[model samples]
Target: MGKSQLMEKHPTGKVQVRAALLPLVLGAALALSGCIADPQPGPTDGGNAAVSTSAPATGELPTTSAPLETTNASNKAPVYWVGRSNDDFFLYREFRDVPDQENPVTSALRAMMSEEPLDPDFFTPWQNPKELATSISGKNVITVDVSADAFNSNLDADTADRAIQQLVFTATAAGASAGLIDSNQQLQVVVLVDGHTGYLGFDHIRLGAPMSRSTGMVAPVWIIDPQEGTELPEGVVKINGRSTSPGNKLRWRILRVEGNSDKTSYLSGEVTASADPSQSGIFALSVNLGPGKYELRVSRILSTQGDSEVNVDSRGFVVR
Candidate 1:
C-alpha cells in the first residue's frame, strides 16, 4: 500500500513499515496491492539484501497441462526469484487438500481477499499452483483450487506476496485468463480448512485470482517491557522480541548509546539478526548508561540495501 520508510539498493537494505501505515492503505476494501520504492540500485544476487523490495515478472506457463492431483513434495514452480540475497528461490508447498472446495486455508485467503482485496498476497496457495487451473468455457468462473501445502505456510504477509505474484504471473500467462481483478467468477482460489475462521478452518473455502501486495509499515519489532533505557530488573536483563514479517527478513541493531540528542557517538557496537538469532531477535544492550542523560539509538538493517533509521522508539527508563 505504501513504500517502505527507508529503501536501499540491496533489498540488501532495510525498510521500516509501522503498524500505523497498514490501516490507511488497507482501508475497507481488501484487494491485491504492489510496492515500488525510489528504486535504489545494488547487487543482483545475495541472500541478505538491505533495501527490502519486491518485484513481479511474467513467467512462462508450461504447455500440455496435467491433472490437478495431490502430492507431498516441495513442488515449487519455476520463478525467477530476482534480487541479490535471499530473494533468489521461491517455495511452492504442495498440500494434500484442494483449494476450490471446502478448506481452512482457502477460507482465510478468500475472506482476506474479498474483505481486504487490496492485500490478497497475504497467503500462498498449494504447490504447482498453475497446474490446478479450471476453465468454465462459457462461464466466467476460474476456481483456484489450492492444496494443503499452502495452508502449512506460516510465512508472514510480506513473504507471502512474493509467492503469490509468482503464481498469479504464471497462471495469467497460461490460458486461465478468465481470472483477474474484475469479474465475479473471474478468479476463484480455493483450499482445505478445519471449518473455523483461523488458518486451520472447520471445513474449507475458496478464493478467486489476483492476490494483493500490500506492504505497509508493519510492527517489525516489539521492545519488551521495562523499555529500552530501563535498567536490570534481573541482573541479567533478557532481551527478546516476538517477530513476524513478510520477507522472512526483518532485522534491528543497537548502534551504541548516543552521547546526546545530536545523534553522534565516539564509539559504537553492531549486531545483526543473521549473526545471532537469539541476540538479533531483540535489540538488547546490557551496557550501563552511567549517570548521565543518553539516548538509545536503534538501526533497521535490511539485507544489503538500505540507509535510514526506519524507527527510533526509544525511551528514558532508569537503571536504579
Candidate 2:
C-alpha cells in the first residue's frame, strides 16, 4: 500500500511541474510573436528623404503627410545673445520642427504614437518611406527585425504614443492623403532591452503604436508568398506587395528599378510598412512578359540599400 501511494505521488509532482511551466511556455510564444511583426513605407530616388512635403497647411481638409517631430530641451522664448538693446533677439524654434517621417530610426520614434484607436483614414500612416531594422526576426513566414535604440532615443512609452498622434494630426491638417497604406499589410512593434529581446510588459515601450491607459500590446504580421524575387512561371507572373513586419500593411510597388542607368524608363511602385520596419519589405511586379533580352528591375520605394541607378539582371527564356 505504501509503495503504491509513493508512485502516485511521483506522478502528481510531475504534473505540478508541467502545470507551472504551461504559462511560461505560453508567455514565451506570445513574446516572440511580437518581435516577428513586419511592414513599413518608402523607397524612392529622392536622396535621403528627410522631411515629407505631404503635410497640410496650418488648417486644411487633411493630407497624407504629417508635420516633422522635434525635441525641445527648454520651454523659454526669446532665446537671444547679449542684446545691444532689447531688440537684438535670437530665433526660437519649436520643440519639434520637422517631422520624423523619413528615417527608419525616426519612423520607429514617431510610431510610438497611435497606441489607441486612431482615425483610420487620416495621415501617411507609417513614419518613413524606408525602414531601419535589422535582418530577420520573422513570424510565420514574414520576416523582419528593427533596432531598439531607435525607439529609446526618441521617447518613453508614455510619451511615444502622443508623438505618433502629433504626426497624424500634422499630416492630416492640409487634408490627409489616401492610398498610402494598402489592405494587405500587417504590423508589429518590438521593443528590445539592452540589445536582447526583452519582455513586452509595461517594463519598456513598444516599437509601434500606443494603446489604452491600461491595455498595452502591439500589432504583428507575416508575408507568405512571392519571397523576395522568387521567380514565377513564364506567362503568368503574380506580383504583389506585403509587410513581413507585423506593422507594415501598406501597398507595395516597384520603386523604379535599382542601378539601371542604361534603361531610361520608370518602373516604380509604392510600399508601406505596417508592423515591421519598411526597409525589410520587398516590392516587386510580375507580368506575362515573354522571355527576351529584358532587364529585371529590383525596385525599392524608400530605401538607400542598393546603387542609385536602376539595376537590371539580364535574363532570357521562352514563354511557350
Candidate 3:
C-alpha cells in the first residue's frame, strides 16, 4: 500500500496530482502492476451492407505472391476482426483453429473475410468472397489482395473511413500478435484489390501507402490483462489499459454483480498512468478480492469542466 495524491482541477486545463495530503480527496492503499492494450461496442442502427460489385476479370494471384511459409506447430492463432458501431469501429479478438502449418497473415484475413462477429454489437461491412491473398515484406509491410468485392463496402464516408481503419487495425494487430511482424515494431499494411492497384473505397483512401493503428478510430480503453473472460486462479488480478489520462491520472473500479444488481468491490487508490499523454498512457493496478463474478471498468476524465468520463472500457469475469 502506498500514499496517493488526487489532482484537483481549477477551471484551467493544467492540474497536477501530488502525494501531499488533501482533505476529502479520494485515497486508499494501492499497488502497481504491469500493463497491456487491446474491446467491443453495440451494433449500428440502419447501417447499410456493402453493395455487391462485379469481380474484375484480372483478379488473380500475383507472381510476387509466392506460397507463404507455414508454421504448422500451433493449432490455433489469435486474430483481430473489425466490427462497426454507429459512432466507431472496434477491433475484436478471436482464436481461430488453423492447420499445423499456415501463414499467420492469411489465417487472420480469412477469418476477417469469411466470418461474422459473434458479438451482437459488432458487424463487418465487408462481404468476404474468400478471394483474398496476403504476403509480407522485409519492411514489415503486409499486402492484402482481395477481389473487387472488397471495394464494395457501401458504408458512408465516415463509416467507410472507419471500415478502412477496421481492416488496417485488425490485420496489423493480428499480424504482430502472431509474430509475423516484429513485436518491438509497429505493423503497417497495404490493401490490394484484384492483384492490381486502382481500387478505392467509399472513404476515398488510396491504397498505395502503408496503414498503421490510429487509436482515435477505435475504443479508447481496453482491459489488457486477465483477458475478457477467464477463470482467475488467485484472488488478486492485475488490470491495465491504454488511454489519454486527464491531469496525468487514471481510475479503475471492480464491481461484484449478483443477479441483476451491481455492487462496488474495489476502487483503485489513485494509480497514475504512463507519462506520455501523446500516446494512450498505460494505467495499471493490482487488486485483491473475494468474488464470484465481477465487472471491471477503467476510465479517465479528459475534460476539466464537468468531470465526465471521456473514455471507458469494461470487461466481465469470474473469480474462484
Choose the strongest candidate by lDDT. Answer: 3
Residues 200-316 of candidate 2 have per-residue lDDT tens digits of: 422233433322111111111112233323444434444433222222222222222334533333233333332222222323333433322223322212235332322111121
lDDT of each: 0.28, 0.24, 0.50
The TM-score leader among the candidates is 3
Residue pairs with clashing backbones, model 3: 72-100, 72-101
Error of 3 at 98 (Å): 5.7
Ranking by TM-score: 3, 1, 2
Candidate 3 lDDT tens digits, 52-156: 111111112121100111233454555454433223344545455655354666766666656654333344555565487788888888898878665554444
When sorted by lDDT, best at the front, the candidate numbers are 3, 1, 2
Runs of candidate 1 exceeding 4 Å displacement: 1-218, 228-238, 242-267, 274-285, 303-307
lDDT of 1 at 84: 13
lDDT for 95 in candidate 2 is 18
Deviation from native of the Cα of residue 114 in model 2, angstroms: 27
User: What lDDT score goes with residue 280 in model 3?
Assistant: 31
TM-scores of the models, in the order given: 0.26, 0.20, 0.63
For each candidate in turn, give its C-alpha RMSD to the true structure in angstroms: 18.8, 24.0, 18.3
